[model samples]
Target chain A: MDLQKMMDLPGALAAFTYSDKGDLQSHVLREGTELTPQVLDLLAHSCVANQAIASMEARGWEALTGQSGFQPLKGFSMVGLEWSVVVDGNCGVVVKNRDADYEATFNALQAA
Target chain B: MHIVKQLMAIPGVVAAGEYAYRGDRFSYEGALTDEFARMASILCRANTLSVNMQSEIFDSFAENIGCRPVQGWIVRGSQITICAVGNYFAFIENRDELLNDVMTIMRAKVGDVQDDLLVNLYARLGGDTKEALY
Candidate 1:
């Protein structure tokens, strides 16, 4: 995923890619944002955990309910009090809550 | 109407429910069987715990960057999306504008999640909030 392009998203404070095990791989931070690499690393790890859990839930829910259209998970977002992180696969973008466009962010992640 | 009923009224909302903070009990309506709803309750519990911890960690790092008291979460699958706000969870189809619509109503209905996590949830579930000491 192109971290720079992810940065172009509205209200994006930082965009990052992480390893399958949740180590921060690469990132770009908008200058003057209060975020630090250390925090982003933690965020990356949390994103990974959230994704894995959500994917498992999707698979199990579909199978148990005999439902369709739930496999191939797309993305997950944590809606914080003032900001949020949207993550898909190994990449994620943190956006200011007031400016978050959930659909656009999910589409961007999917395209990447 | 109750919040769960309100959510179920939305066009693409297939299942809506109120789940326990620890995944022990739940009640749901619409397409899911009882066993499926129980699994959904467990899933919501896991996601809630994960996000609450992350919120606390973020708060510690930034000292009130407004990431505290997580409002909710959403997971979008290929054609189904699950959204949880407060103790309520909804599974909806991915038709155009459905996610946004369902999210808007859910957020408006549930309001903000309390910082007193366990206490707030227990109070809502009829437990003694003061004694919980959460």
Candidate 2:
């Protein structure tokens, strides 16, 4: 996906794509934003770590219930006072404003 | 113990537990096996640590643009929902439909008992029991 174009959505302050191992793959930041690559790497790893935990939880459930075909997680969202982060797999989008339309932003990200 | 029991009392709360940031379970109650519950608690602690780290990074840039600190995180999956309250963690299973309501109740219940919880945790760690009361 064209990550930069996807990041151009309204209220999107920054976006990053990482490998399954949490390595930084690509990123976009709004002009004048003070975020750094090191910080971005930390954020990416955090997202991947979250994904791993969710995956484990899913496996645990499958084991307990004898249920097969557990689907991997699509993504998760964290809302803060000033920003909201949505992470899907290795891709993460950080909205500038807490009130940003996360649903639309997520839809746009997926469609992109 | 009381907190776990209260959390378990809530509708759809399949499991409730308290764990240290280092992955030690203070208490837990649910249908999950002991090993599975411990793993979940530890994973939840890791998730919380990550959230806190992310928040700190954002805070460093808050001066450039006004931003408030992160309060907490809620990660909802198909079969479970994990919630972080303070340094403690809780997870619910097979209750995706009641996640929001359960979280709200759990948060409030946790708040009410956090002092006692901490005291007990302190004592469990072999800290001075008298100091824990304060």
Kindly report which residue pairs in candidate 2 clash with one another. none
* Model 1 residue B8 CA deviation in Å: 2.0
List the RMSD of every prediction in angstroms: 2.1, 6.3
lDDT for A61 in candidate 1 is 73
List where candidate 1 sits over 4 angstroms from the true fold. Answer: B132-134
**lDDT, candidate 1, B27-121, per-residue tens:** 89988888878888887877887789878877788787767898889999898888888788999988787876777787788888889777656
Residue B23 in model 2: lDDT = 65
Show where candidate 2 strays beyond 4 Å: A1-49, A56-71, A79-84, A89-112, B1-3, B63-71, B93-97, B109-134
Per-residue lDDT of model 2, residues B10-119, tens digit only = 77676677676356655678776777667766666666556655666656754433323443466655555566664455566544345545545554555522323334
Clash count of each predicted structure: 0, 0
lDDT of 1 at A83: 76
- DockQ of each candidate's interface versus the true one? 0.73, 0.24
Which candidate number has the best TM-score? Answer: 1
Write model 2 residue lDDT over A2-111, tens digit each, in one string.
77876776678788888888888888887876666666676787778776766776677677656443345545666554566678766888776433554455556556
Model 2 DockQ reads 0.24
